[model samples]
Target: MNIAVVTDSTASLPHELRTEHGIVVVPLHLVVDGQEQVEGDDVGTDWVVDALRRKVDISTSRPAPVSFLRAYEQAAKGGADAIISVHLSAAMSGTADSARSAALESPVPVHVVDSRTIGMAVGFAAVSASRDAAAGRDVDDVLERLERRLDASSVRLLVHSLERLRRGGRIGGAAALLGSALAVKPVLHVQDGQVEPLERVRTASKAIARLQALTVENHDNLPEWAGGVDIAVQHVDAGERAQGLARTLADALSTKVETTRLSATVASHVGLGTIGVAMVPRIAD
Candidate 1:
């Protein structure tokens, strides 16, 4: 059976990779300085950063269910027997809810999956699902593979400012340090599908070091080091730092690392100078 893979733009997947895997991405909507812009179409990481620098007010909204319905319709028309719609964590946004709502009306079966993480973490799951789908796996097998990767993945984000998060009401467990000084960086992670406090550091350098240490620990503790794992370094307007971290982790783990810039939908909440690493441990059969 032909199973089509779909994910939101928040996955931060590169255009070429999505095209290569036959994955369709539905973009989130963003309003910057009272001008509405679609996530991938106009509002991206650079645009969000620039708007923030100009003291512009930025807000985000989840895509409507119709957008997803249209995508499902198009997929069905393209000879897809089914669709697997992957999305950002429900705890963080309502994008998954919209996709699930659309799935109910799809002509073919549509399975909505919550990646339970954002950025490259979602990208990893979507890519896994797409690759297996391309390999002629049935819808059930493709979903199973995606689930295994989601369960094994871990993400850590280092944010320079938590103000945007607090304003967006997505601070979750990190709310404990809301009153902390602006210079006191916070290290957050996805736990139980919600953004939780991992720890707090005084400086960006220390936070980066902590992220590296976590990457190393996960790499060493994998069931089998040779089984292979995927590492992704994602950032919001922190390209240089993300590249350096990707290089270091790649060398230490002796594997390649994928680096991507966060999309506007994600950057709007995380603010600028945010960098993180997502590690998906290799799951054994």
Candidate 2:
């Protein structure tokens, strides 16, 4: 059976990977100072960082159902027997809902999976699905592999401030931390598809250190089925710091680490100087 894999820009999958795997990407929308632009296309992390630095109004919107319908139609036209659409967390964005709406009108069987996470965690899931589909695995097998990757993944972020997240309404339980004393750095994580506060520190240095320690701890605690772990360091306007963090992680974990810029949609919420790490277990082939 020929299956097609689809994902959103917020997945943070590199262009090469997406192209190599034939994964179709649906971009979300970024509203910049009242002007709307497509994420990853018309706007990217550089634009978002500049806008944030200038205090420009920035917000994100999910793609319309028609956008996803078009993607499904094109895939179907390319002779796909089925499609698996993986997307970012529903708690953070309505992209999944739009995909579902399009699936109802699709010509082929479209299975929309809410990754319940963002960044490389979702990217890894899409890659896994694409690989399984290319291997001629059944739809169920492909979905199973995708779910396994999601279940074995953990993401942590260190942001200079929580104001951006609060302003975007993406802060879940982390809202309480905003009331604390000033100059407090926050470390957040994705839990139950919502961004929640994990730790609060007085300095960015301390927060970065804590972020690394927590990642190491999480890596050590993974289940045996994980086989191995893949780590990706993500940042918004903090490339140097992200590279440093990735190098430290690579040395400590004895594995290669990939550093990628967060998509504009996510950066709009996280704001500048945001650094994150996403770790997913590599399931045995």
Candidate 3:
């Protein structure tokens, strides 16, 4: 079967890579200044980060089901016999549900995958699935590949504060870390589709160190597929820091790293000055 891969904007896959892999991206909605805007390519990260710094009240909405329908239709028109619709974690947003609703009405067979993680964590799976499809793999094989990615991948976040998370009501499993000393920096990761506390450090520097250590440890612990991995360093209003972190990770793993700026939808919840890494420890078997 000719399978197609689709993902939401929050995956934050770079345009070049998305195009190269032929992954279809559906954008989520961002409400800014009383207007609805699509996140990702439409609203530039630079402007969103700057607006957040200026205290703009930016909010996000899950992509409407119609958006997914259009994306699915486009993929079908392109001659796809089936579609693997991957999206951000269900615990994080309703984007996956929206995709599922569209899947039911899609012309071709649609398999909705709740990535259970966001950013490059989801991007990694989508790209892998796309590669599998391009190689003439069937839907079942592509789905199995995504399952392995979900099992082997991890994402760590160095959030600026818990205040934004709490305010946004997206704290999920990290709620326990709240009401602590303001100076403490919380390192978070996705656990079973919810943000959970990974570690808590006394300062931002310590948090950065902890993140770096975690990346190195995870990379070293990978199985045979270690040689082929996806590592993404992402930040909001901290591009220089992310670039530096990416360089350190590349050196530690002896592999190249990808860096991306978080979209406004993500920035609205994670807050500013957040830096993190998402990695697929190894290629799927």
TM-scores for candidates 1 onward, in order:
0.96, 0.97, 0.95
lDDT of 1 by residue, 157-250 (tens): 9998888888888888988878783758899998878888898899899999999998899888775523678889999889999999999998
lDDT (10s digit) by residue, model 3, range 1-285 = 888899988888889989998899998877766777777675857767777777767778898999999999999999989999998889889999999999889999899998888888998889889988888888898798778878888999999787777877889878898867375899999889888898889988889889999988888788765447889999998888899899988998889899997766777788889998998855644
* Candidates, ranked, TM-score: 2, 1, 3
Residue pairs of candidate 1 with colliding backbone atoms: none
Computed on alpha carbons, the lDDT of every model, listed in order, comes to: 0.88, 0.90, 0.85
Candidate 1: list runs displaced more than 4 Å. 223-226, 283-285
Model 2, runs deviating above 4 Å: none
Each candidate: RMSD: 1.5, 1.1, 1.5
lDDT: worst 10-residue window of model 2: 176-185
Better of 1 and 3 by lDDT: 1
